[model samples]
Target: MNRPHDPAPGASPAPRATDWIGTPVTADLLRGALDLERTEHGVLPHRLPARARAQCADGQLAMAEAQPSGVRLVFRTRAAAIELDTLRTKMAYQGAPPRPDGVYDLLVDGSLAGQASVTGGNVLMVDMTTGTAETRPGPVGTVRFTGLPDRVKDVEIWLPHNEITQLVALRTDAPVEAVPPGGRRVWLHHGSSISHGSDAASPTTTWPALAASLGDAELINLGLGGSALLDPFTARALRDTPADLVSVKIGINLVNTDLMRLRAFTPAVHGFLDTVREGHPTTPLLVVSPIHCPIHEDTPGPSAPDFSNLGAGKLQFRAAGDPAERAAGKLTLGVIREELSRIVKQRAADDPHLHYLDGLGLYGEADFAELPLPDQLHPDAATHRRIGARFAELAFGTGGAFAARPA
Candidate 1:
């Protein structure tokens, strides 16, 4: 029953089986979603919207903004077999020992095709000695992939950069649509948990999806693992989504979640760069700061969790605040890279498309003495391919800081 072939001479015909569950998943076939909502058991994908998830009700920023790190679902198909039906949530830890399921990669026209996972949806749990949490729901699972290569290309799938998905239903065996918008340049970023790919390996080798595939662009990752915390609903979810390029990174989850000081982190980094410059007034934002972690680079945190190699099953992280708590105003990565390079050179004197990298110019300290951070604070998978090839040769090559502005 792998059907999905006949329809050559003049094409356009094969969508029968009662028109495959009435197709339509719309929103231009999803691609790194910036917002998709419609919940009640279908389509969730929000990198942060619904008014920045209703201005925070924090369950770890609602499980890191529904965990869709570089979310995906693209389209264009001559389906040989496909079925999505999600509703995931996953994430455990209570007594420990389960973890490792969320994957779902698929690709196709852009290569590596096939890789799936989905089993009994919702879970959550977490306890870590009274930090407290609970979810436990479970049900809609599905995943199916079957042969695929019946003709019309581009598929994608991706999802699960650490489960929390929602989606819910998407059968197929022939007709499918939206795979259009591809001139690249979307970017958007944001950070923490090493740009939410902690211990990176999949979800397209995240290092902001390998610096959005060496800066050709189109990422939208809002890297929320540990919720990048500069909230104001993540600067109004980066001032209402739509980006041509913009970054944020900022201090290691506010010095490992000690969450604030240095007078409310310099007015929460000037009210999160004034609500992302009221929707990217001039785009090209940047602002990185925070890398060479080495126990929070001058220590100060709420970090703690180092089950001293629990009989070698490993689990580490240590800076539990206090390098003499920087005379009480805390905060470290060397005082958030000298207050984000003095608030991006005092707001680049009236924001000249403001910029400021220095996250140790992408993982500093002699590449951490030749690549270290094996969980003293993220960055693995060959330091996410050496910080996505040094942030595509420092922000898209040529004169950097998100180059491309020559007319």
Candidate 2:
């Protein structure tokens, strides 16, 4: 493949549609998404079906589920050039530094081939203090990738994990068809912002995505940012989705959001696991506790943004709840990890396919000292890679929880 044709991320006039063939963005072409809702502008891919979305009016959950962490368009074609028209809605923190535009990753024949970012679409201005937001509409933009090999091959365009994207159209110089499944096991994962690819360089580089690539599994990522609080709707969605392997990374979001106390945490977890097993009985299911986060390790949350560096164009977070509150059953990461381990052990006796992974094993105190979380929450791009590599080894490697069994 030739060097990627990269234009800066910004608004540009779209190429005339008459020059290229247009393909409808349909469900068959989409992978890793549970539903596709038709909008006035285009079809928006959703990780959670409409029923699950209808049950929650929380804006955070709505945005996170629509961002499409692991969702991609996969097809077979000989097109030497491709253009995707998308209406992307990005978020901006009020009084804080502007976040980068989300990236669109292109893979040819299962390899990283090219990457691009769309410029203009929409922006959601958010006030961290007030928890309010305003939407500013912009023009739809196009992401173009050229100089692909002129031969029959598979192509995949992974959507940005942090942006709400609407597929306006797909244009190519040649015809395209859906790529049939290659029989790889499907790995479904659900977690918080870190697993949602918060600061990762691009979509395919997210830890869960990286682990899936290494494990040679198809990924369905439900890593909703700031919204993985063991919601019943989420568990129900998991229960209904089809998957050969499954994992749920729990704790950080619960602690940070202060969504529950010890009294509710145990039963919530059991219910979540029970729901998943209803659909995937005997399938390998792994339960992961929180990784090492110093701020929440001993202190309970209701985490708040630290605006001290706002003038310097940086944003950080602080655990606001008192450490003493743990005595009242308020949850902390330390408390969460212990409780999660106990819950899994108790259930595993009756569920042979169930397993537990201490998230500390993926990123422990030692790793933290070497590569601390940049914002005292989500991992940086380097840390994403590190965590992804370790997870692949421990979860998919020999004797691991998700290890392949003899047929």
Candidate 3:
């Protein structure tokens, strides 16, 4: 995974497209491009130009938009920005900038006004920009807005970054269309950045997006990058919100972020699941463990290595699950793999409606060899597809189709 090295000085991770991919689009069929993501954190935002056709009368400004989740739009990039003059469909996700070479500047109205903001918006931000795609998808810059307004109307996008590439995803103020009563059931998925599409190639490629399309289910993706601590808020949110099919993908973030100890991991997990169960007593539930991340497989997690040495600032992280508890089978993926099964089994004995899927089944050693994360974390686009298709099969296909059967 030797990237040419970002034209920027230093940065990491420009990740996942949701498992939301459709067949690749041919170059000629494209109409115009609009960015569905971008903000202060890192990525930029785009508004469909009122006079786009006139603006690009020659042959430029290509884009497409889809509201996979109804409320959230996935903006795909093709050839946009006549000035930039270059665009590629390199898979982009919602994380850090793809490259670490140059300091990027943002543009508004064809003029350099500001940079994409990542935080303090109304909703969480997914991928907004990209840097490179290699081993695993490389590091790309992204901005996560906490909450966004209900609508926006504007046009223009510019990235004075490395200039290697200029693919994008911009957020809009448009409201997700309301679902008619008794429409397709809603499917809410919870998981790590992979579930969040850390750096696929674009927003729609996120697994949840892909699965949602395949299942024809409404989607509420709670895939938070660098989040998902099995915190009470998440559970409460699930309990308070609504869903017909719910699945929680846990593990990789726990291990990669190096959070929690075996002592607290199990109880926290139980409580999180417990809260979700409270929301929909009869909903089919699936609890997935981590996919194969060799970092934690044979090795006891809760291991911390120093990253400060590599970058400019002080850096350190404790892998999830404490050493002592991991050995006790309470914190390791091995532990989660077993415990998750036990949790559902014990619950299913009484619940009769619960199910489980080992993340290992989604993407493991074999898949890793085919596509590895450049940073030793996060999966690439190919892996996203592998996991998404596998998920639809295990969770929704066959008799287990996520579709509701006669009660």
Candidate 4:
């Protein structure tokens, strides 16, 4: 096999045309995607299936599910070099700053092997002030990873968690085949932006991805950014997906959007759980409350972008709703935590497999003091590692819900 390699931090050169073998990006060679749509350019992975997506018209959910936070190409190959042609849709905010290109993480035999990013692609420009977006067409880009050990090994190329990527083509110097399932428990997780990998170093470094690694489980992440607002469609998506372990991180997005009052939130939570139970009656289901966000702990949200530092090329967020609104049934982080705890406790009376996790135990005020959130909302990369470690301990540790069972 040709041993072409690149040391630069960005894109890599593709293998020579005639010498490389082409492989179709099929669902069997992919993980973490609930549905795959055949686009004009290539295949697009979707976190939510077509039925659920058809029910919602919200733009945020549409974009979030299409980003493929935990999606990756998984296969067995002896290829010394690999190349992926992709059409990526990158996001840009008007008057703010150009976000860095999304990263692609490569793993060999469950270990991080290399990392790279595709350069120019479609740009989705959003006007933060007007809440409107325009898409500008661009060309497909290639990301290559070379110099493998040249032995039979399992390989995974994790797609960017924050960008919409359409897989155009995959090429390798050697032949490729479907990797047999590794027998790891499939962990399906649903959460907010933090779980969606905001500010994470790479796709595999996201908290859910990290925890999945530490827990020795295969992951299907449904962590939609800014859209986990207890929507029925989202809950249905979680219900329909097959998984051995299921976790839903609630409250953060609810508070961020101020989408519902306490009365509505309670029934919504129950209904969401009910739908999931229909599909997974005895599956181990864990409900996780939101982590500590000082800005939204007591203050109700309708969190708005703190563009005060936009001129300095930094964009932060701030809670816009008044704390006094909580008295009038408005939801806050603190209130949501308390309600989630109560609801889980009440339902656990009959549901032996149901569990509740306090997000504070994962990243509380103490941790916040040491590693503050850069955007005043999402955790930074370091915090992502910390949270992932704590979660693995709490949920998959001995006597935890995801602990291994002996035959």
Give lDDT tens digits, candidate 4, residues 1-407.
11124533433444578979999999999999999999999999999999999998999999999999999999999987889999999999898768888999889999988888887789999988788999999999888887677699999999999999999999998999998778899999999999999999899999999999999999999999998888888888888888999999999898888889998999999999999998899999999999989999999989999878886778899999999999999999899999999999999999999999999999999999999998899999999999999999999999888887896
TM-score winner between 1 and 4, please give it: 4
Each model's lDDT comes to: 0.80, 0.91, 0.50, 0.91
lDDT by residue (3-70, candidate 2, tens digit) is 12353244233335576889999998999999999999999999999999999999999999999899
- In what order do the candidates fall by TM-score, top score first? 4, 2, 3, 1
Q: On residues 95-206, what C-alpha lDDT tens digit does candidate 3 reach at each position?
A: 4333322222322222332233221112112222232323222333343221211223222232211122323333222322221233667887777667756545444456
Give candidate 3's error at residue 367 in angstroms.
1.1
Reference-based TM-score, model 1: 0.37
The lDDT, on a scale of 0 to 1, for candidate 1 is: 0.80
Each prediction's RMSD over C-alphas, in Å, is 17.2, 2.8, 15.3, 2.5
- What would the TM-scores of all predictions be? 0.37, 0.96, 0.56, 0.96
Per-residue lDDT over 1-407 for candidate 1, one digit per residue giving the tens place of the 0 to 100 score? 11123332333554455756446566688877677888898888877777778877778877877788888889888887777788888887765578678777778887767666878888888776677888989788877676677899989888878888888778887778888888878989888767878767668888888777777788888888888878787888788888888899888888888988899999889889888889989999988888787888898998888765544445678998779879999998898899889989998999888889888878888998998887688877789888888887898889888977766
Candidate 3 stretches greater than 4 Å from native: 1-182, 302-325, 328-330, 404-407
2 versus 3: better TM-score goes to: 2
Task: Count clashing residue pairs per candidate.
Answer: 1, 0, 87, 0
